[model samples]
Target: MSVSVDLATVWAFIIAFAVFVYIVMDGFDLGLGILFPLFPAKADRDVIMNSVAPVWDGNETWLVLGGGGMMAAFPLAYAVLMPALYTPVIAMLLGLVFRGVAFEFRWRTRRERNLWDIAFAGGSLVAALAQGVALGAILQGVHVEGRHYAGGWWDWLTPFSILTGVALVIGYALLGATWLVMKTEGELRERAYHLSWIFLIAMLGAMGAVSIVTPFLHVQYTQRWFAWPNIILTAPVPIAVAGVSALLLRSLAKKYDYQPFSLSLMLFALSYAGLGISLYPYIVPQSITIWQAASPEKSQLFMLFGVAVLIPLILGYTAWAYWVFRGKVNTASGFH
Candidate 1:
């Protein structure tokens, strides 16, 4: 006998894949901006910005896909979660807008360059923080009475949310430092290696804090992680994280160009997997599930067809762009 397939689960994974791609792709550039203040010289900033200039905007395609796919494939989750998360969502969008504008305008002017640089860093910082807080708010649980959200406006704001926000900032900064280590040369690379040591330690601490706090936020999370038979499957995640952390530390210490960035991405992927373990089946966590929130089967089928065509095209172009732009970004002749 053949098993039945679930479209909702497929769509859920698709969205998850998109979001993860966005985090890793756009993440490094946002990190570059966050680390902008540390490299105050004009030449350093120019090289930093140029490293990502070819592909920064394209990276946001996944963000749009993730958000739009959710609204289409999981309308109920969208309806309920939006109202509950409007503040951070809006803040995230605004931050992206400012960062995008700064990316362009910063190159066009000299006198006003510093202001745009500030905007670039500030916007990146805000976007990363808001994303983390929004994630924490969702993980902590949203108030749902019947089909609609019943929470107050400030419901998203909390100590847990704040902690997650700070954690993401540090994590993105780590991604940025590692990217610099991979893509630059000489003093910039040296400084990035130093910063990587600092950010890696900070990122680990943040990850530990989030991991420790997560189980207590819900009994289900505790059961999923620590309860009996489940631990057999879940145990390897942390172990793999430990192994990867050791490799990353060794890579950075040895000053390997590419391994640091690759290892950093692995750490992020593991953390994301841990998150999925905590909140599987439930799109809204503690409330709505993927099946309950999914659109009609016919609607899902129609959209899946579109996604099949769209995703490959996206992957093709994205891969081509990166391949074309591959290798170290030279300070003498930038992308611009």
Candidate 2:
């Protein structure tokens, strides 16, 4: 039997899925960018770049799709959200651009490698900080004036936002550290494994602080987590995340080389899944439900047909790229 479905629900799911992919894919690479400065050797650094350089550009495409889908499917949300976030958005874009340019031009010219290295690291920090701020604002809820945000510029950069910023920095570092455990070996790999515990602990502490404070900031969040069936549904997320993190720490501490990184990756995935589920229905988080934020069903239907074609093509190309470059990086090699 065929069932009639709400088109806005479908659009919401698609946008949400795309956002998930962005976090899962680019999240780690951005983690790599955040951790790029830690590796002390030139060859080891190449290996870290090797882990993400081929896929980083492709990973970022999900963000574009997610954001574009949001803008097209919910023009009202876009109108309100973008202006409120223009400064951080601009900074994020600039950071990404600067890092991308440095990534390419850096190899092309030997003379400016030092300068470009600084740019890459600096760009990573800026982008990560802006993203964290944007996320914090959403979680804390913006001051909505009719259809617009009525908050000060400084309002977005609250202590909670700053905490999230540092939290993500450590989280990205955890991703990178785990990545190194998987991809590199010898002392470099050992250092990465050891560092993961330290950073993971830091990430846990930050998340703990946020969990305590989030409920006080908004009533709906309190109800969502603390009330009735929602608590039962949500309890598994934190429990699972904790279990996985503990296992990952145990493995890394024991110097279990092969699966430590993968486990850490799984832990990250589970945590992000909880976040997506928690924030479901709210594109702007409590300000607007996906249905209220949606464009006409006709618009989404047209977009869906195109997305169905383009998404698979993107997946295929990403797969092919990984297959073609399926080896560790070396400083001796240059892009051909």
Candidate 3:
């Protein structure tokens, strides 16, 4: 209602949008990395690598933006969350570092290409799993007492967190496979289509498991979803997510090359919306409300000016990179 309240809420939404963009964009390339080891043929793997090479770095820009935005706009949340999630956060960064290094070094090595390939795939797997675990740990809730994490070091390693980690692996694999379906042609495209279906089924199973388990783990979340008027308002979120998934499955079944990828993006959007709704007004799940976590209004407004300028530039060049590299990856051209 007040100016500061509006500022905090706006910043919260901005941080969420940045995170959503990162997940959808980086998710596919990370998916590609995860799929690297699947195709045994060296040439086929080269094409897959090339398909993502142009935009992979640009795709990661959103991640930096998201982290930086949160640190700037909601410093308290960043402080509390970072310590609470230190282990997985470190693992994720290490995985990403391995992925980036392997992506570049693979092109240069003649005898050691295989080693890099293994690293790429392994890195992707670790990063994806760590991210998922982090998500589950947050959703299951954190232990905070007077602005500090109160849980043990191994609190993030629970069975539910591990399950969520596996789900994220499937989800990212689906995103990658669908992306390949869009950008590739001939045998690779066909292969991608097949993998997309496999990953889709896996994703469905994971989502179903997480869906069933989430409410039982978090009473507030359960009440929010099932309580009369709130349930009426929120019911469409899951339904829309299901519809998107169905559309993706149908597209894959029909062998509609581009539609599967587009539908996957829609699915990501809906799922993110559902997540944001479920955790509304809370930057650190149930522990810290947005207003409690937000920096001063003047600080947020100052940061907003920079974000407004930077986001458009980031978007423009990301679009340009994609447009420049549009088309099926030509394997014969070699890794550049």
Please tell me which predicted candidate would have the highest TM-score against the true structure.
1
Cα TM-score per model: 0.98, 0.91, 0.97
Per-model CA lDDT versus the true structure: 0.94, 0.76, 0.88
Ranking of models by TM-score: 1, 3, 2
- Report the C-alpha lDDT of model 2 over 162-257, residue by residue, as the tens digit: 777777677777777777676666677777877888878887887778667776777877778789988998888788888887888788778876
Tell me the lDDT of model 3 at 135: 93
Which pairs clash in model 1? none
The residue pairs found clashing in candidate 3 are none
Clashing pairs in 2: none
Question: Candidate 2: lDDT over CA atoms?
Answer: 0.76
Per-residue lDDT tens digits for candidate 3, residues 227-316, read 888999889988887888888878888999789988988877877776777788888888999999989989988988988999899989
Flag the better candidate by lDDT, 1 or 3. 1
Error of 1 at 51 (Å): 0.2
Model 3 scores a TM of: 0.97
lDDT of 1 by residue, 16-125 (tens): 99999999988888899899999998888988998888899999999999999999999999999999999999999999999999999999999999999999999999
Worst 10 residues of 1 by lDDT: 1-10
Specify the poorest-scoring 10-residue window by lDDT in model 2. 327-336
Clashes of 3: 0
Provide the clashing-pair count of each candidate structure.
0, 0, 0
| RMSD (CA, angstroms), candidate 3 | 1.5
